[model samples]
Target: MIGAALLVFGLTLVLLLSIHAAEARHPQADFAAPLSYREAQAVVVAAQAREAHLRTVVSQPLGSVNPELLPRMQTIYFPQTGHHLSNRSGFLDFWRANGQLQSFGYPLTEEIVEHGRIVQYFERARFELHAEYIGTPQQVQLGLLGREILEKQGVPPRLDEAQREGRYFPETGHTLWGRFRSFWERRDGMQLYGMPLSEVVEEDGRSVQYFERAKFIYFPEELPAVFRSLQHSYGYPLNALYEVQLSDLGRLLAEQRGINLAPVPQLEGTHTWHPALWERRVEISIGEQWLSAYEGDLLVFRAPVATGRDGFNTPVGDYAVYYKTPMQTMSGCMAGECWNVPHVPWAQYIVGGVALHGTYWHNNHGTGIRPSHGCINLRLEDAQWLYEWTSLGTPVKVRY
Candidate 1:
């Protein structure tokens, strides 16, 4: 009788140990970032280990009899938690119709009736249904729950409607339109800008619009055909095009906002560059008085510069940084008079004798002051930075 009892105890102990080993090998499952198809499979597998009968049920396709769970709606069941969540009917349809995962994430709570409206919660969004069908596309709308919730938690709220709509530009008396309008819309209109803070105006001779998040300047010359349409739409006269085309308004606007939107690039800890690297180019905006370096489509560096004086217009066209010198003496002549500049630094020759170089001669690099003799002049430090960042044969584009 004693031996039989001991044998039973040993068998029970072995069974418990085996169960613990199995649990250690296959742990409980939870989604970290989000549930992908493969991740959902792993979660199901873990659940099956916990309940053998669940294997047969999991093998069957995840189906829903609910009419709302159609089109893009997907029903997901979590065996670990024994809870099911779904993108069903109204809220799911609204989310897909609007922005889906881009605007709002998957649902967190089931649809609940609140204040005579159906509501649901998502990771980053909240949805509410209205029968009146007054605003947005569908009867469903995104609640400003995030803003309200944050404000209750002592966080600052976003700008109000008055602040967002922005004032008009007193100089031009224009509003946003054309390429500027298109770019703004594409970049997420109200979400980014809230509203135009001011009317379209000229800060320092450039067409500009101030928004809550950013400032946009119009460059008509960059796209002439498009500008023609813009000019026609805005009813701008032919005479004003030249003045609007050449101004340092973007840089000045950025400075007023206290932001460095034109970020410089660094090559340290990067991969190698080849023949196509020289294909990178630089652009000098005569109106904005700004020079921008680009690697392919990416803007890498930007700085202020002084271009050629009145009569000696810095020829605007395509050129290349063909030659470079750390220090040199630049000499030129106009009619009967001759002039010489000595100890110039970081010279990168562009066209003929004209070059982009560092000027210790003056401190008015980006002050909209023109003091150079037909050469693009930079502050000493800016010149040095450009010298190190650029290479021979880099294309140069000078635009008005």
Candidate 2:
């Protein structure tokens, strides 16, 4: 009887140990046991989920027609607002996102399921939202005319519900986006682009009375969502310059200030530069003492600047504006400390980190003094002017 009891106890102990060992070896012991259905479903579901996310991320949100993409079926007739959406100006309420499967196509790779249950699911999309940019000024002009400008003269300037056809912006002086606003405030224009020259009464009778031509450029993500708000449309109005020669905002100001106006083809004597993305473009002429600004393909602004101790000889190379602090604590070998100077509402990334900005400490800007720590210095007003005149991405070229 004693031996029989012992044998039974030993058998029970062995069984329990074996069970514990098996449990430890199980892969899903930390969580739940994997169901046969779950394994299979996860494979397909995961693939579908990945596909959905990719298409969604690539496609533009369906708010307005993307001027560059093909119209999808989901983006059929726009704006069920009892108004016909024009294909030319692309007038519509919502430019629906084009994530819908254009046609039945096999996904590159989807989830692989080992069981019937869902491990993951992902659905691939065939097409994406159209990029509908209004490149031509004529088409854009007609669209703006269709949607009459709603001028809300309030504390915060805005253009409510005034849809942009190809492109639209109000003349607001508060900001630096003068290029678009320059076109929107025109008294008379055939089209914002491709318009022939015509006669017009100049505010300054001394300046040319002929109306300057117009131009339009299309960029997918040039402006941000906040700036695109209609309310801030009129905040950044044109300075003394934006009125006359709209395309080249600087020309209007130069003419108004009676500043020495360089002829349009200033490139005749010099090389006309075409800009590229993030190009290191700061042109410095030691002989002429001028600083030129370019934002990609456009020559935005140019001015004269003073360099270093004529000895440290400000290193000249193609550079971008890197650091833009409004009031910086400037320290140098010669100039002890410049406590405050209005520097950056805008500074382009050019070279390693140095940039061309304003100086309040030194009033004498163009007198040719070398009191700077390698950074080119401009007058406060000139600096402010340049600050408000460029995009953050503009290139500054400083070639000796």
Candidate 3:
């Protein structure tokens, strides 16, 4: 009986020892134990460093045009604003293609990760990178800085719904009237400035209306004294101020955040060409009956065009606009056909007697039915816009 009892005690001691050995080899996690303050700070620093490295890798151009050539990115430096724009996070391209300095102001910060997305601040805009749309043009988007600013200042009491007039927008419960509406339509405001956030309200002795992207302020006295002096010095039109001007909300916000405005040295990807950097070019596709206008390589406008039909085909060649007039009387006879056209609006002579002119007589443009007698026919509005957009010596290409 004593030997049996001693054997049981020995077995129990062995089992306890085995359990401790197993625990030493594979210990349980101490999830409840808090990290030390120093350890926690080190973890945060490591995470930030990793994010910065990832951003750098993403900003780099993927491949070169040739194995021998190094991949080149594009960066633009604004001397006036002492700011540089890197092609990081698609900011530089968007800025150039959109409105450049006029619409977005200068870059206030380099691309930085904000709320799990990359963003860069401009004087008047905040560009957010949508990684999901990386390859598309919509990858970068403008933040609702206008709306945000208005909210912080305390949004004015909502206007009575019944009293709203002049091109009302139900989306934002705002009315766009007077010169503001005209400017909005002319400038393609929906894409540029976004929806109006408030009706015209007096703020700091100025009439202002807030939009999702911008704040429009009415200049009752027309061009301010500073602008008038600039106009006089530069021979610029005073009306360019347009009675209503965009407030410098971008700059305002950047200052509020205490962002570093000092300019940095131009980066390695400093020299690359984009459509915005080139002269205006127009291409006419004879086969497609289409006209496309480009600023450098960027296609800014396109419209249907009626080229010469059959034997009176449009001369397919590269030409430059040597002469242009808003209104002209075109009288010509070709291939047993005579046309005595009166008041040909927006006539731009490209080669010999062949010109691009507004056609009121025919509505068939891009219907594959070319009816013009050698001249390229365009709709009145299209012709007018093209006429105003192009200057003398602008390149024009007519291709089959």
On TM-score, the candidate that comes out on top is 3
* Ordering by lDDT: 3, 1, 2
Backbone clashes, each candidate: 17, 64, 4
Query: By TM-score, how accurate is candidate 2?
Result: 0.30
- Measured against the true structure, the TM-scores of the candidates, in listed sequence, are 0.33, 0.30, 0.55
What is candidate 3's lDDT per residue for 1-400, written digit by digit as tens? 7997687557534533433343233221101112332343333335334444554454443344353453244555555565556666777768766656556777777776767988888877888888899998678888878988977887776545565558989898788886577667756788778988888777789878888988888775754454345445645333333377778887787787777767765444333222224456799999999998876566667778998776766676665564667776666554465667555677876555567877666668789998876678886656866787776546677789
- lDDT value for model 2: 0.33
Q: Which rank order by TM-score, best down to worst?
A: 3, 1, 2
lDDT of 2 by residue, 1-400 (tens): 7997687557534533432343343212111222232332233234334433453443433343454444432122212111112122221111111111111111211111213321111111111112243353222221111111112111222333343343222332122123433333332333322222222212333222111223223231333333234215434321222222322322332233344422221211111111121132346775566766543333444565776554435555432233344443443233233323322223322332244655444434556666655556664434555665443333344455
Better of 2 and 3 by lDDT: 3
Q: Give me the runs in candidate 2 sitting further than 4 Å from their true place.
A: 1-280, 334-355, 367-369, 385-395
**lDDT for each residue of candidate 1 in 1-400, tens digit (9 for 90 to 100):** 7997687557534533433343233221110112333342344334323333333344333444344543344444333223223444355445433434434444444555656777655544556676687454556655544234323333322222332233334443334555555545533555533344445555456666554433455665643353345446545322111222212222333244353333223212221222132235789999989998765455556778988767666667665555578777766556354667666667886555567887655667678888766788886556766787666545577888
Q: Could you give the C-alpha RMSD of every candidate to the true structure, in order shown?
A: 26.1, 26.1, 27.8
- Cand. 3 TM to true fold: 0.55
The TM-score that candidate 1 achieves is: 0.33
